[model samples]
Target: MARRRWWELPPAVRGAVEERTGPVRCAEPVATGAVSELVAVLHTATGAHFCKGIRSSNPLAWMHRNEARLNPYLPGVAPRLRWVVERGGWLLLGFERVAGRHPDLAPGSADLARVAGVLSGLASAPAPAVDVRPAAVRWAGWVDPEVVDGDTLAHTDVTARNFLVHAAGVAVVDWSAPCRGAAWIDTALMVVRLVRAGHSPERAEAWTGSVSAWASAPAGALDAFAVARAGLLRERHRGSGAPHLGELADAAEAWMWHRLPL
Candidate 1:
């Protein structure tokens, strides 16, 4: 399928969308993953809302729906699910846009702790009977026992770009990669991403440890899973054509091998 340009959206469709969503002043595409397109829409009355467009045939539609269903349950952890429109084999989900700096650009121990607490709450929540897969399972042999057994809800994509620090608190966005697994899996991904971005190894470790401590599991096991899962994620993203991803993955792999003991 040819990549659909944001400007190419039909006036009728755009108008209908705006009417349903409120008054959209500006719409700009925000690139994140390969399967879906995210548009950050600035509404004159509603402020900002993110419109996530997904193909009807995409296997991850279940994940998106699950996220929508789970958002209300997680009051402050995620953006509010505003509206969902299905048209022409596409699912456009509108979410309240989180306003603030990306966690990576403005790293702080307080922010990390707040995010950790939010994740922990989500993980401790009762698991849904959704068919979402475990992220650790995707990497096969690199799987960590803690992640495999915890079976908590995991936001597989916990990168800084996915986290939005707002006045209400930090809200995590982009739920297309939600997983039904351990909270440690999410923590590991976040720590690894931060470490890859030049955060001190000691700081990353400490943050991970603190998050794990809040989780209902042994810290050592969670740490092990975080290390191994970080390695696997880095290895997979290392081949990505995106220069930043490749660079981050390479750095994460090095940190996994050097800073983390086998």
Candidate 2:
């Protein structure tokens, strides 16, 4: 979807936001992320905060609500939600701005360890009693529903863009797809991303050594997830014809093959 600038927001929507955030001195539009109609850093006299929103008519608009609802439960690993704005057919969420860059997931980057630490921390996050679907149900046809079942909260989208590396630590963003799943699900998802970042499948799996959830996850369950993830990515690539999706699909395929018995 095409991104809308902060100024493009309806006057009513902007007014509703300023009512909470005060007048915006400047707005820096965010260029990353595939979703969201309007995403920008609104700078006010007090401070700058991140705001992302979509028109209520969009089918995925519920994602904004979920992110707002889930942010409270994810303190250290995710940004804090400051306020919400709903006006003129748009629902916007304002978040405490996180100053960070996308993590470098390559073989030797120091950021790798930081990424591992954040994911490991997230592994123990108690599942919030929200309306999120179970991971098994979300991946039902692609993965063995039983293997992905667990009680911890999982940020299903573990892409590099969803993670921000900063002075404090790695903060995971984009909670639109949170789910109830196995504790190691995020780490398992990251393995495919590790391969996409230039690590061979063997080295990528090895990188998980520091993540306790990955170490304790049932091998059979991990294997099931790998295969299903590869298949799912392939289908997505075929449907969207997006180059990055194809690259990730290839990475997932390599990981799936590596997890297969010798």
Candidate 3:
């Protein structure tokens, strides 16, 4: 998607946002995220709000709505969704601007400890009764569909980019594709991301020591999931040809091989 500045939006769309926020004072574009036609922090009479918007007719538009619907279920773990506005063929979302920086996931970074604590909190949360896709369905082709079932809501995409390390703790963002699955699944997913960030597979798995769900997870299920995740990453990389996806796919395969018996 082409980058869109706040002023570039149609007046009707800007007016819709102003209705909730009063006059907009300034807008600072956020450059980190891959999605969103427009990602900016809007300063207004209401203070600062992180706003993301996309054309309403886009195929990925449902992701915006999914994030809005799931935000209520995630109180402290994520930024609160303040408002949603649809006008001039665009859908805009406003979120409370959390003051923080992206976490460092390297082995000795202090931020890693905070990330572990936050991931543990998420693992313990029961799945919200919402219309979300199940992990079993998402991994059906690559693993035994039944192996991924559980009552916990898993933030399957636990990359370093998705977490904000603040004074209070860590906040996970981007709830667009969360799924219902085993409580240990997120810690498992993070393991690959950690490996991608320079942790050896052994140390990455060791970091999950504080996440109780990881300790109790069935060894067979963990093995199955690693293989399935690696397979999926490989397929996605082949299709997208994104360098980062290829790197991540290699990391996932390395983690999967590390789990196998010699």
Candidate 4:
């Protein structure tokens, strides 16, 4: 089946949700990735809600299901899940919109600290045994093996864009890549992305330390995981037209070659 636009949800589904939540005032494309489409805000009588659209063709349905199942267990990590709708070949999940901007827009020691804390909290939560091997295969071209194995619950994609800063606190979103692995995997991914975005090494290191302290992970593993993750990012984005890919690849290569020697 062809992909449907976010505005093209079945009338029945829209009606069903509206009856409970009120009308959807507006929806804007918030984030788009290889597996799923994310919408910023779907206004209802209660308030604005974030909607994540998952394509049936994508194999990350398990991840979404895991997210729905694990949401209750994770505190202050993600927005509250309002509803999950499966229509035709697509799945639409509605969540309370986390009020805040991406962390990149507002960088600070406090913001970084909050992000680290959230990530750690997520890693520490109990989750069912999930087969992360397939994820390793799918993301193998994009991430290092060292960061993709073991029993730790790792949020593989931990870029600044995944965080939402609100008046109350920060909330992390996008669980499509949740995998069982070492905690450092998530930290490594975040540190690499931050460095690629031009954050100083010291700041990135500090953020990594904060995340480790919050998550209770070993500090020595941070540098190795970061190097491996940087390489993975470089390999994945090497030929992409996205301007940031080149910079990220360069930073990853430098960090891997010089600092981590990986």
Which run of 10 residues does model 4 get worst, by summed lDDT? 126-135
Query: CA RMSD for every model?
Result: 3.7, 1.1, 1.0, 4.1
**TM agreement with the true structure for every prediction:** 0.76, 0.97, 0.97, 0.76
Q: Which of candidates 3 and 4 reaches a greater TM-score?
A: 3
Clashing pairs in 4: 152-181
Pick the winner on lDDT between candidates 3 and 4: 3
Would you list the rank order by TM-score, best first? 3, 2, 1, 4
lDDT (tens digit, per residue) of candidate 3 on 115-159 = 899988888889888777898887877989778899899888888
CA lDDT scores, all candidates in order: 0.64, 0.90, 0.90, 0.64
Candidate 2 lDDT over residue span 1-262, tens digit each: 9888888888988999999999999999998877799889999999999988899899999888878877877647788999998889999999999999998899999999999999888997778876778998899888777899998999989988999988877888999988998999999889989999999999999999999888889999988888999999999999999999999999999998998956
User: Candidate 4 local accuracy as lDDT?
Assistant: 0.64
Clashes of each: 1, 0, 0, 1
Q: How well is each residue in 1-262 modelled by candidate 4, as lDDT tens digits?
A: 2344557776876776566568877766665444555455677667887776665557767767766766654456667888887766666777887878787523464566677777777666644454443435645655555535556666677667778888887788876656666645666667667677667655665666655432455444555555555766566686565667777777666556545553
TM-score of 1: 0.76
Clashing pairs in 2: none
